[model samples]
Target: MIEIALGALITLCLLLTGTCLWLLTNQREHARWQVERDARDALRDQRIKELSKRLDAYLTGSVRMGEELQELRRIVAPLPDKLNQMEQRDPSSLSFTQAARLVGMGASVEDLTQSCGLTQAEAELVSKLHQAQRRKS
Candidate 1:
């Protein structure tokens, strides 16, 4: 009977050891899964932060462009009034036609802008167009 009891105690100890090992293995697997989940969450949060910063910059640029457009409109609003005043002063002096004529005659862009009231860009465009026309002819 004593031998049988010793055998039974050994069996119980082995079963307890196996249970403890299995519990430890399960706990370790769960810890690994938790770690992976935390890492993924952190990466996702960092991406969101970066995208938010980019979106804010885009919004700022859009607002700046809108303000610049408003200022350009403000500056251009008086052009019609000025054109009318110039026309009243001298109806026969059409500046754009005069500028184009001067461009065809090989006038400098500065001369077009000063003497004929053309912008430098307008003078350049007229010069280019007349040059192209002359080339085609």
Candidate 2:
């Protein structure tokens, strides 16, 4: 009976040691997994910050472009009325406008006189003005 009790005690001690070792290994595994998860969360947060900055820049540029477009629209709105006024003021001015367009398209003085009914002196003047405007630009 004494020998049997000693053997049972030794077996119980071995079992307790094995259980303790298993619990320790399990705890270490959980700690390692938590660290890896924290690292991944940190990386994800960094990426989110970078994307947020890029999105802000893009939105700022878009707003700037929208403002520019609005200004362009405001400037262009009066053009049609001005054009009508110019057309109503002088019939000869319309011919001059047409002759200027022809000159801009590389028309010769003769072409302007024939096609646009501009006088020779007027055609020459238009050609000179077009040349000067091109040089200024």
Candidate 3:
């Protein structure tokens, strides 16, 4: 009976030691897993913050681009009217070819200047040059 009791006490101690080791190992694994999960969560949150900042920057750029485009449109709005006015001024000055023809017909320099809107010196030059050409021909 004494030998049997001693054997039972040793067996119980071995079982208790095994259980304690298993619980300790399980607790360490749980701690490691918790740390990894926290790291992953922190990384995900950081990425989300960066993405939000980028989106805000893109939105701001889009709004600025839209405003610049509107300003450009406003600045250019009167260009067509100004172009039409310039086009309509065609009747102000007679064509250079017409002035040359008139010079060939013996029109005076003053007449060429007034009718063709040429400067006095330009009219004189054209008259002299064309008269010389006519004499040669």
Candidate 4:
């Protein structure tokens, strides 16, 4: 009877030891998984921050471009009015040849012709005259 009781006690101790080792290994695995999850979350947050910064820079550049375009428009907005006043004061004052030269100076042919009510032939004559002037210069 004594031997049988001792054997039972030893078997119980072995079972308890195995259970403890299993629980310890499970806890370690759980800790490792938690660490990996935290690392992934951190990496994801860093990527999000980088993308947001890039988006802000792009938006800033676009705003700057828009502002520059507006400035250019403002600078050129009074040119048509000045041309119209000049046209009203002198229809024939600027000869077709002179008008052509003005066209060559970056004035649109349509705008120059319309403002002066010039025929295509007259516009061409002005262009030829401007070309001659350019050659002289």
Candidate 5:
């Protein structure tokens, strides 16, 4: 009877030891997994912040471009009227080519051509007129 009781006690001790070791290993693994998950979440948050900053910069640039475009339009708005007045006063005396030349000396040829409907020959004439006028001035 004494030997039998001692063997049962030894077996119970071994089972308890195995259970404790298993529990400790499982706890360590759980901690490692949690650490990995936290790191991934932090990296994702940082990426989101970077993207948000870039989007803000893009929006700011778009707004600045819009303002610059509006300002350019405002600066050029009076030119057509001035050109028309000049033409009205000297229709027979000034040719389209001469007008185009004058416009080219100070303004964009594309803008002048579109506004005044001047042909390429007229644009060249206008450029020549502008040179002559500058010389006189």
Candidate 6:
């Protein structure tokens, strides 16, 4: 009876030790998995913040471009009327404008002087100006 009691006690102790070891290993694995999950989440959050900043920059640039375009529109709105007023104010200047157009069409200085009634110096100046304009274009 004494030997049987001792054997049962030893068997119970071994079972308890095995259970404790298994529980400890499982807990360690759980901790490691939790740490990895947290790291992934942190990396994901950082990436999201970077993307948000880029989006904000794009939005700001778009708004600024829109404002600049609006300003350009306002400045150009009265240009046609102003040009007509200048043409009406000086009817003879129309001859010079036509002379420049002819020069752009590859006309010679003598042609401008004859067709547009420009002086030789005026025709030469118009030809030079249109040639310079063409080169710049």
Each model's backbone clash number: 0, 0, 0, 3, 6, 0
Candidate 2, pairs of clashing residues = none
Higher-TM-score candidate among 3 and 4?
A: 3
Clashes of 1: 0
Candidate 3 Cα errors over 4 Å, as ranges: 1-6, 92-137
TM-score of each: 0.57, 0.65, 0.55, 0.55, 0.55, 0.59
Model 6 residue runs over 4 Å out of place are: 1-16, 95-97, 100-109, 113-137
Reference-based lDDT, residue 49, model 2: 100
Top-scoring candidate (TM-score): 2
Could you tell which candidate, 1 or 6, scores higher by TM-score? Answer: 6
Q: In candidate 6, what are the lDDT values of residues 1-137, reduced to their tens digit?
A: 99999999999999999999999999999999999999999999999999999999999999999999999999999998997788688665456777887887889988887787888999999999998988999
Task: Score candidate 5 by TM-score against the native.
Answer: 0.55
List the global CA lDDT of all models. 0.88, 0.92, 0.91, 0.82, 0.79, 0.90
Alpha-carbon shift of residue 3 in model 6 (angstroms): 5.7
Off by over 4 Å in 1: 1-9, 94-137
| lDDT for each residue of candidate 2 in 18-87, tens digit (9 for 90 to 100) | 9999999999999999999999999999999999999999999999999999999999999989987887
**Model 3: per-residue Cα lDDT over 16-91, one tens digit each:** 9999999999999999999999999999999999999999999999999999999999999999888767656797
Clashes of 6: 0
Candidate 1 minimal-lDDT segment of 10 residues: 91-100
RMSD of 4: 9.5
For candidate 5, the C-alpha RMSD (Å) to the true structure equals 10.5
> 1-137, model 1: which lDDT tens digit per residue?
99999999999999999999999999999999999999999999999999999999999999999999999999999999998678678865556766778887889889887887777798889888888989999
Off by over 4 Å in 5: 1-5, 93-137
